[model samples]
Target: MDWDFLIDIFQQLLGGVPLTLQLSLLALVAGFILAVVIASAASSRYRLFRWIASAHIEIFRGTPLLVQVFLIYYGLGQIPGLRQSVLWPFLREPYWCAILALALNTSAYTAEIIRGAIQAVPASEIEAGRACGMSGLLLRRRVTWPIASIEQGQQGRCNSAVP
Candidate 1:
């Protein structure tokens, strides 16, 4: 290829960096929120909640991301009443579909990371927090949350570097 032509192509590709970053960041935030919910549910005291969360994680994680994207983007439109619904306007857009797919996919992976991280926290730390008059949300916030956050950060870095 000509040097100038290669440089022009590179420049054009560079123009898409902002969009890529925007999508990644949006997905990251959405996924993190969803992951936290799923992880909480999975670890809940109620069997029903644990079952529901487990099913959600299994369904999402078992499927290919591309398949999920196509199903969300194209399959929804095929439903008889979906096209006429008020939500159709937003669903018809590719931007939302892509974001939804990315968010869902990322959430599944992130949920597993979070669940593992939470489980990895030492029991003694939680006990210590309780002994200090910290219980329920307070104990989690002070003891478990910090350790899990670090694990999440490490896992996120490793995942991002992979293909």
Candidate 2:
């Protein structure tokens, strides 16, 4: 073992801490917002919207992220029209591709967690919101959302404390 070389590599890795923190924080925030959107869509009264969101969640959840990374980074890039499109600039970067894949994957998982949490919320709470003249978006944003956020925060902290 080369002690000096090992120490140098460790120091270099530490230098990347800021970038790692930035990426992780950005992904978490963006993914949370996306998850909320997905949950809302999944729970919508319209069948088409619900089906689209459900299918998105199912596909992302069912597949391993490595495959998604490959598909988004390589497969999509291989398409001639996509390569020529304005999005190609963003897609060409491996970092963004990886971030996009991770965000999408996380959003899918988070959406399920949130959806389950929302469903687990007491029906009475939603009814109470309705009685208060809060239906549609108001019921969800006021009653269900806060509960889900608390549940998610607890889950996140628990998961982080684990090995």
RMSD of 1: 5.1
Model 1 pairs whose backbones collide: none
Error of 1 at 132 (Å): 3.0
Query: Where's the lowest-lDDT run of ten residues in candidate 2?
Result: 154-163
lDDT of 2 by residue, 1-163 (tens): 9999999999999999998887778778888899989988898899998998899899999999899999999898889999899999999998788778888889999888888888777788878889999977787789888876676666646465556
- TM-score of model 2 relative to the true fold? 0.84
lDDT for model 2, on a 0 to 1 scale? 0.86
- How large an RMSD does model 2 have? 4.5
Residue 138 lDDT (model 2): 80
Which is the leading candidate under TM-score?
A: 2
Tens-digit per-residue lDDT, 20-112, candidate 1: 999889988998899899999999999999999899899899999999999999999999799999989888998888888898888888888
Q: Which prediction has the highest lDDT against the true structure?
A: 1
